[model samples]
Target: MQTNNTPQNIAIIGAGASALFVSIILAKKGFHVTLFEKNPKAGKKLLATGNGKCNITNKNLSLNYFFSSNPSFIKYSIENFGYKEFLTLCEEIGLNLVTNENGKTYPASLQASSVVDVLYNEALFLGAKFSFDSKVENIDFKEKAHIISGDKTYKFDKVILATGSIAMEKLGGCSSGYELAEKFGHNIIKPSPSLVQLTSNDKEIHTLSGVKSEANVTLLVDNKPQKTLFGDLLFTNYGVSGNTILDLSREANMAILNFQKVDIVVDIFPTLDKNKLLALLEKKKKILSGKDKNSLLLSLINGKLIPFIYKKAKIDSKKYFIDNLDKKDLQALTYTLKSIKIPIDGSKGFDSAEVVAGGVNVDEVDNKTMESKKQKGLYFCGEVLDVDGACGGYNLHWAWASAFSLASNMK
Candidate 1:
């Protein structure tokens, strides 16, 4: 093993968020760091984050924000590298940040490219080398660390795998990172598409396509309420896509993999309960006694969605007058409005997924340093690990946190 004071040769695969962060840290720590990216440019996915604004980090850093097969695996790295330290480093590297009311931090310039540029510039200035269009194909860790990319082979004292997951192929996401881990005797949890749009077979969903609403979404796995999230939801010809659905999708993906029943229960009127909504509808019915059922819902709900809502309640919009509606009709409408269950068959797949849910099992990696337990001089971090975070800036936080932890322990 190299001594703490000695400069070690380090190889990092993939040029995503964690790769860049760890490379910057280790290079500044006097290590000779070389980042190998398959793509012509680094941070291709990073450039697309937060719609180009780049949600860099969250002010509230907690273990609850992250998900892993080993749930507590993120605590050590996160405790070592919190948002304050990350923000300080960002400032030192000349990247100004702004924290909004929601505690989601972004570049003051509001450009994801700006964040990536600052990180790349800092790493380069610190003497870190970058090899673009260099996709690593093989790793021979039998004797020394030898990584072969095509015909060329590079040896290193230590290698860090920061290659993300098989999500968003448009951004160069692939399974090479997981294959590397498997070669080193690490077990990988089968990856599934998370934070992606849901696909449904419900024909009614097609009619309400393009309709957006603020709603509470609950994911039911095996007929149990696994999780809930609140945000804006959008109906598409495919199915449901939005902040709320993406937040709840991790559980949906996992459940689908288990062959368990998966369903999305959306409460479009989350602020009002069943009884309250029923009372409101009753009062409205009295006022609009002569009007048709469609007219009564027009002022209260999205016109495009009125037909679907009434149909779910078993009420005929064409025949029923507001006064003719019975208790059963009101109850059905209340329940439908409060709990509109949409059966999710599958996701949009990795091509449309924002992040993947599984990776190199965290049990095979050290939480403190993100070093692989199965091999010396090998490390893992970011989405390549089992750890994944919710939407907003949590996933980026994991990247920085795990990278910082690994770099600190590199000799």
Candidate 2:
């Protein structure tokens, strides 16, 4: 894998998965590698992934699943060090990965700490130097070094910037990567929070707080279906938020920012056809003609959404049975269950996104080695780049692949 057949002294600018992984691979080859992080420990964000399970990679891997300014650039890294290589690296580092029901790989111990521990320990074992509480302030391209904590400076022949984007402010993420990119003459895409929870200012969200349902959510960009996600969706006082909403958050936010009305289409019953749902409802209405709609509806749904559904359907809580049902009325109920619309007020901000979109434009960096075209002996990787993938281990996969690219190209 080391085509260069030699090691290079490398200074990794961040202690995140991207920098740690590249240091691990390069140091294992007897390269001089030093990883710098402002945090007290490495992999702070790593432990928070997958709600602590740390979804390492997904089974469904394809290039179409990612978004980038230069779409073709990610093809090289992903093709070179795809999901298989990530698993292999875990095992090589003495961490056994176990696959979940959804094909998401996790540490066998089910502890995210185990994965972070392995990466941290492996890097150390490979002779990688880690300097915690080392914040890199400005970069000096002319001197080939980074200014740390506003004053301290770390010089190197080759530098890898992987501090990540401005998402997750609570987790200590910022635009240091962007600042470094600008210092090196690289163009940065306007950063927007991605993979974060959406919060609406609408009062209807209050009615459905804590209500979750199996639904098909479609993102309507200018009332046109841009993408659709099928999964479990949960609603809160903010808005509809879940893996489903997060999947389409970028587009939804972009649309909302453009002053276009953004709406979420949730089909609570995607499997049941209109006629089937209508027939079942009709039969149920006949069976419980005397029962009030409030109680009967509770049994129909998951109980939490009965009132919300009634309000959405404009159905009277006490109305039990309509003497005669017209096709249009039946259609209205069917449509209500099949296509529920919710407005997107805004996202919870960058402090909560799993990954941020819009980074250093990918076209400025060669995916083959993650080297920046704008600067010599400088490489970029991880969330610092524009390429971002859908949820389910895709972002982690990018980190692994980009790191592998950098390590393999050492000379």
Candidate 3:
């Protein structure tokens, strides 16, 4: 695998977001690039993203938005092929975009299939060929050629290991990406499930199953608050879910593994502060004196959560007004509603996770080129690497940013 000057028939393992980028950019450079996908289709996982709407990239590209083993590794690629550049590329491929209020970019059509189709079209137009049902068994580098996918060996002057990670097993993800990296003598930084819903050990959450509310979740690691998030929280038989809970799930996973107390503080009535909430409840009691608990509570919170909230607050359903409530009762109800706590015991794992965290350590790869420090012709990109970003379009941004360098660096 010498860095010899030769026209590489670059072989990209996996037909995911990064693989498509590799194919398009390398093929455009007039290099022969073959994409191998184990699934019956390319972008199977991509098509499943954003609830099939496909959040392509975040409109903003800032360093604080992502996490990685090598914290600085993403700076170069992100700066070069940033969010704006990615949108421009999408536009070039006939996929115009719309940025949401929070800066998450989606296709104008709002269908993930539209984005996948355009990416597929771009790769095909660039002369890259895809081989489906082509599962890779092993990869070895010899004189600028990669022998991969078992006996069906591939010869490439440069090889991009954009095989992705083990997240969606039913969709063919099983650490093939990590296996490919290890075969090339690279170190993987322990893979685990992330961006998934957490199951709580507390029995209370189960009783309130099917109840969803706009709340905030704060993650505790080693009995310390690690991160906080606010959004829609869904209660389930096993545990808690939804946008807010998912953001803080990784911390819950880590803390739960260590047998630490992992809890989510849900601010059910985020719009009303503690004092204001109490005042509002007192005022409403006088206005709706004869109404039942469900009726009065429904006007304030979702009717679905009334029973559970009443149970947690130790409030009698027979009584409707705060006029009969003592100070202790008022404070308890406010605390339970404004800061309901759920214990984290387990997670939905890869199946429900949007993306997997903790992959090939960034220390072992070149940031600018994504070339493995241990292997001459090998490269890593996408979720298979150690980079994990926050919700929104940050994950897709990482994939595109990492692969953009790989595609450009290929000779």
Residue 70's lDDT within candidate 2 is 86
Candidate 2 vs 3: which has more TM-score: 2
**Residue by residue across 243-362, what tens digits does model 3's lDDT show?**
887778766776666678777778888888999998877676677666654554676787767777778888866665545665676677788888776667779888777777789989
My TM-score estimates for the predictions, one after another, are 0.97, 0.94, 0.93
Off by over 4 Å in 2: 1-8, 143-150, 316-328
Per-model C-alpha lDDT, please? 0.90, 0.80, 0.79
- lDDT value, candidate 2, whole model: 0.80
Candidate 3: 10-residue stretch with minimal lDDT = 1-10
Q: Say which candidate scores most in lDDT.
A: 1
Clashes of each: 0, 3, 1
Which pairs, if any, clash in model 1? Answer: none
- Which candidate comes out best when scored by TM-score? 1
**Model 2 compared with the native: what TM-score?**
0.94
Q: List, residue by residue over 346-390, the lDDT tens digit for candidate 2.
A: 888788788888999888888787888988888888889998888
